[model samples]
Target: MRLALFQMTSGIDAASNGDAIAAAMDVAADGGADALLTPEMSLLLDRDRERAAVRAEADYPEIAVLRKNARELNLWLHLGLPVKQGDKRRNRTLVIAPNGEIAARYDKIHLFDVDLATGESWRESRVYEGGDAPVLVEMDEQEVGLSICYDIRFPALYRTLAEAGAGLLTIPAAFTVPTGRAHWHVLARARAIETGCFVAAPAQVGRHEDGRETFGHSVVIDPWGRTLLDMEQGRGVGFADIDFAAVARARVQVPALANARPIPSPVRRGMAAQAN
Candidate 1:
């Protein structure tokens, strides 16, 4: 399947961002892409709770437009992370089928609450409620696992998805410039290699209206951990032709998943000392 990843520099205005997304979808469809994936917070990238809260609605207008576009273009569309109405609001990923129907929704499992050494900080949990369940959607006879930005840090989640028969993993992110520069490609490639699955990461790039900058090297990795396509630090579309057969071949070569072993409970410190 041909996959197109969009690297965007979104801002506080939902309408403008929606137009950009629509235009990207058109580009992807024109390029013969079977699926189009977007970066996190595709609609709005503001850090202000008040501004973001005002736009949070269950039936967001952007979603409706995307649904229509998906149907018209006959493409599988993944809206990276859109804000949803709730008590604390939700950071959600929506998968739209070619028929323009909602296939699945995955809320961001890990909220980014960090204090970086560079003095940059974020408190995502303060504005958004985190999801406990991971989501996997099946498309074109292949199981695709879904995750958002910070969720990529937790290897166990990807392992669980791979064990559950996911052949492709999607991690849509609006990563900070610092973290993205240091660990983006390394971690993304690691996940694909460890899980023996294709990793498609659509990312947010450049500076936004909120005075925050994002790392924009959107990349697609094959199961063997090779970077098939990378959109290095720009606002544009990156495309890669993905073959599911590569996933099967990688798993067969390593057999790591099949060789996985369960761990026993840790021994108490006192008990271990006594035994020694």
Candidate 2:
């Protein structure tokens, strides 16, 4: 299947951002993408949830427009954690089926709350509550796992998804410039390697009007942890065709699942003293 990852740079205005997403969908369609994905905050980028609250109102025009556009285009679109949720904005992903109906919704499990040494700080929990469930969607005759930006850092989560029989994992991210530069590619590759599944990461790039900058470089990795497509920094589309056969092929060769062994490797509390 041909998949497209939109490397977008989000703006502060929700309406304009929505329009950009629509346009990107068109580009992906023109490029013959079977499925398309956008970065996190696909509609708006703001640290203020108080303002984002307005997006949830039933009359909010942007959501309707997005739904209408998705239905019209006949594209299976994945909008990554759009800001325009509801009274309580969930860092959520909306899967728009070809019929225009919302096929599934996945709220981000791991919030991006962090304090870094470079004077960079994020308090996502203050605005958005984290989601706890894992979402698996039907796609390309296989199950696809859903995850967000910060969730990629957790290895156990991906392992669980793989155990659940997910062949593809999608991570739509608006990674900060600092973390993205340092760990984006490595983490994406690691997730694919551990899970033995194909990974598609659509990302945000460039500086946002809110004074926040994102690391671009959207990536797609095959089951064996090789990059199939890499979108260089900035606004654009990256494409890669996944060979379903390869998914099984890689797993059989690695035999990671059959070989996985779980044994206690960490320090023991009282056991260390008993040795003395």
Candidate-wise lDDT, in order: 0.89, 0.82
Instruction: Give the least accurate 10-residue stretch of model 1, judged by summed lDDT.
Output: 50-59
Estimate TM-scores for all models. 0.95, 0.91
Clashing pairs in 2: 56-86
Tens digits of per-residue lDDT, candidate 1, 1-276, equal: 999999999888888888999999999999999999998888777887766633454556878988999999999999865565566767888899999999999989888888999898788788788987988999888999999999999999999999999999999998888788899999999999999999999999888898898889899999999999999987878899999999889999998899999989987788777988
Question: Among these predicted structures, which one has the highest lDDT?
Answer: 1
Supply candidate 2's per-residue lDDT for 29.
84
Model 1: colliding residue pairs: none
10 residues in a row with least lDDT, candidate 2:
51-60
Q: What lDDT score goes with residue 137 in model 2?
A: 89
Cα error of candidate 2 at position 30, Å: 1.1
RMSD for each model, in Å, please? 1.8, 2.4
Residues 108-207 of candidate 2 have per-residue lDDT tens digits of 9887777899988788776677787999988756788999899999988888888889889999998888788899999999999888899999988888
